[model samples]
Target: MIEQRDVVIIGGGHNGLTAAAYLAQAGLDVQVLERLDVLGGAAISAEAFAGVDARLSRYSYLVSLLPQRIIDDLGLSIELAPRRYSSYTPVPGGDTGLLVDNHDPMATAESFGALDAEDDVVAWAQFYEGTQHLARALFPTVTDPLLTRSEARAAVGDDRLWDALIEQPVGRTIADTFSNDLVRGVVYTDALIGTFAPNDDATLLANRCFLYHVIGGGTGDWNVPVGGMGAVSGELERAARLAGATLTTGAEVVALTTEKTVRWVDATGVEHETSAEHVLVNCSPHELARLLAAGDAGPASTADGAAAPPAEGAQVKVNLLLSRLPRLRDERVDPAAAFGGTFHINETFSQLQRAYDEAAAGQVPGVIPAEIYCHSLTDPSILGPELRASGAHTLTVFALHVPDRLLTEANNEAMRATLQRAVLDSLNSVLAEPIESLLLTDANGQPCVETKTTRDLEHVLRLPGGSIFHGDLAWPWAEDDEPLDTPARRWGVDTGMPGVLLCGSGARRGGAVSGIAGHNAAMAVLESR
Candidate 1:
């Protein structure tokens, strides 16, 4: 006999677990089916390398935008590691550029004094104030989907908010806000994280919103979860289980059976039919389309019409296991900056744009613009004694300018080797220490290695173009205008199909690790039911 449930959640990622937790808390029987043995999905940590405990993969990283209310409501015990201010732009000569909070901003001003001192101080001050204002205005809209544009306008008032919203790209905004080019460049680079857009692109302002919204406040104070980002996912899983939600790992949902009133999902080879009052999909819209297309042809058409098909976009992520901390000329800056701290390698806006141009042209950038962060520096427990002695670190390089489709037809060995060479070469140009001293370890710590190319992420996660944000963060898609709670057919938590809801990043006000999408989706499901 087919098993039945009041609610069936497909994909046991953080969002799925969040939805399940909330639903169960509301007195519903919810079962979550996850393909992997782990529960966090991309937010998971695994000991891909032998000897090492577990590390976060493509989606591994820190999150600050998660509201305090969720933690309090769920009684989550996940503690965020203390965060330090971020440093940016390591100069080639004896000078090292830094940007930190609580410190005298003059230190950074002096570093760039030769470039343009007057411009630096004036611009940095304005940039700081503007981001502060933007954060105050944008945070509420992100946390609550019910916020209306009029409410947002009222909060910031019409003129200033509209000017910040529509006037300039993030890069330009930073430039216009500050007199210092270094400050503008450093602040503006945050907009490029997890995106394929250039700093000059107007869409980057919205991208900045994505980064800023997740920062809790706008100024880039990032915090890692205790243990690892996996901890956050683990806590969500615990919360789900405590709330009476069933989670089945290593059980992939291969297809969905849909009728006008009900849907059944097949997991792996076993067919588990479930009669649910509601079904929540935590996978990407593109993945949902393929699953529905394989089962119900009619709904497949509707899902496709809702969004574009999954295609490779221009972006790539490189995770490296290092034997020791990289040596830099500025030894004063913590080596942890290599992993948990954010650093941008692009020296100028043109260089940053060229990286995107090369990716758009289906080629790798001659000079990659990267945001490098090492998690081991933030969470020392991951480092064994040998690593701790040598200050070994695990570095995640978010490199732009890699063709989104490079993995589609490239040789795996050649691709890996090429990427390794490129990364080392980039570091050699800036770091004072030897690159060879840092040992390389594989996913299993054996002679073998593990890496996720654009194709791997696309095939496994079904992110179109390997775009993690789901869809581009353009104007109409942001703020109170966001489709999160809207009744639209194209976007929003409401899918027009009653009893069915979207909890993925593709939904309105989507992207990042905030889980607002899932929370909003669950609320929508409850209201509709």
Candidate 2:
């Protein structure tokens, strides 16, 4: 007999756990099925190198965008430990780094000034204000479905919001806000992170939304989870279980067996049926589509009648172990700089765009833009005895859009080495000392690039184009025109299939670790029931 449940959530990612937690809190019998042996999905920690402690890989690292509401609502107090000093952008000149103190724009500016007093004060002030305004204006829209053009205009005002939205590429936004090239480069480069778009690309304005989403407290405050991002997931799972949800890790859902409106799940070789009033999908749209296709279970047809296309986008993740903190030319810099913050290295707009172009053309960019973070510096507990004595560190490099074709080429190994070397060389160029002191150098790492590729991401998470955002955040794709709520269908949290809801980053409000999608999906499920 098929075992029955009130709700069976597919995938045990943070979003999935969040959804299950909320549903169970509301008194629903929820069971989470994860394919992996552990929870956290991409927000996971694993031992990449032997003898080293586990670290976040694939989509690893920090996230401040997780809604405060989720934290409080789930009572994740034990699981959530906020680290001080979010991130840093080290200047090439010397040991100077622009430090962000947990969303305090003023502090960030002051820190920048301390590093360089000349023109940095004025430039940082302007940047702080612009990002502050942009962050406030954009934060609400991320978790919500895009507004209609008229609604967007009304909300943002016809004159101001439209102007910024239409004309503000990263280069333009930075130029309009700051005078210093170093500050501008640091701030603007953020808009291009994880995207295939270049700094000058018009789409970068949309990318700015991403920067806004991750900034906690304010424009500059970033937080590392106490143990790594995996801790966030672990806490979410505990909260879910505490709320009466049953979590089954290593139980990969192989198929969705639906009998009319009712759905059942098949995990591994075990078959379990769940008769829930509503079903919430926390996986990527592409993954969901494939799961449904494999089961012959398609999306609810449109009013006019049509199914949505699969999600797509290519991504590559690299994790490195270091023997010591990065040695920069600027020694006067605080040793704390090694922890709790990101260090970005990109000199100009042209350099940024070339990287994107190379990735688009299926070639590794000569100059890789890296967002390097050291967890040990942020979380003292993770500083194993070996690290304390040796000052070791973990670095995750999110190289955007390396073409899949490169992997098929005979020189793929050479290409990977080249890409790795470029990132190391770039960091060394900006630092005072050679990276050799920091190199732990291990060829063996867990969760290969194949796990994060557009194809694999699509296969696993169902994100079209392997795009993590669910839908594009570009001008044409904003608000009402967003793919989540197209004229033919509504894939956002509320408007999808009556009993089906969306909680992934790709939902209406778009990407990030924020629980907006899950919260919204849960509310929708509760309200419908």
Q: Cα RMSD (Å) per model?
A: 3.5, 4.8
Task: State TM-scores per candidate.
Answer: 0.88, 0.81
- Best candidate, TM-score: 1
Candidate 2: stretches off by over 4 Å: 78-120, 137-162, 165-167, 203-205, 211-220, 257-268, 272-275, 297-315, 332-335, 338-340, 401-415, 441-466, 470-491
Model 2's TM-score against the true structure: 0.81
Q: What lDDT is reached at residue 425 by model 1?
A: 67
Please, what are the lDDT tens digits per residue for candidate 1 over residues 86-137?
A: 5556653444555453355665566556455555666566555655666666
Which regions of candidate 1 deviate over 4 angstroms? 53-58, 92-95, 99-106, 114-118, 178-182, 202-220, 260-268, 299-307, 311-313, 330-340, 410-413, 440-450, 474-491
Tens-digit lDDT track of model 2 for 1-529 = 5456667677788888888999999899887777777887767766656655545444646676676667888988533356566556666655576676765768776776765544666655544555566555555554454556556546545455346434556566556666555666666555655455555566554344545443444443456677767678878888998899988876755555344122333445655545555666677655555555556566552111114554334445566666656655556556465446666665444556676788778777776666666666656555567566776666665655454445543554565566566666766777777765656644464322122444455445445555666544433124554454332123245434446555666556546666666776776666556
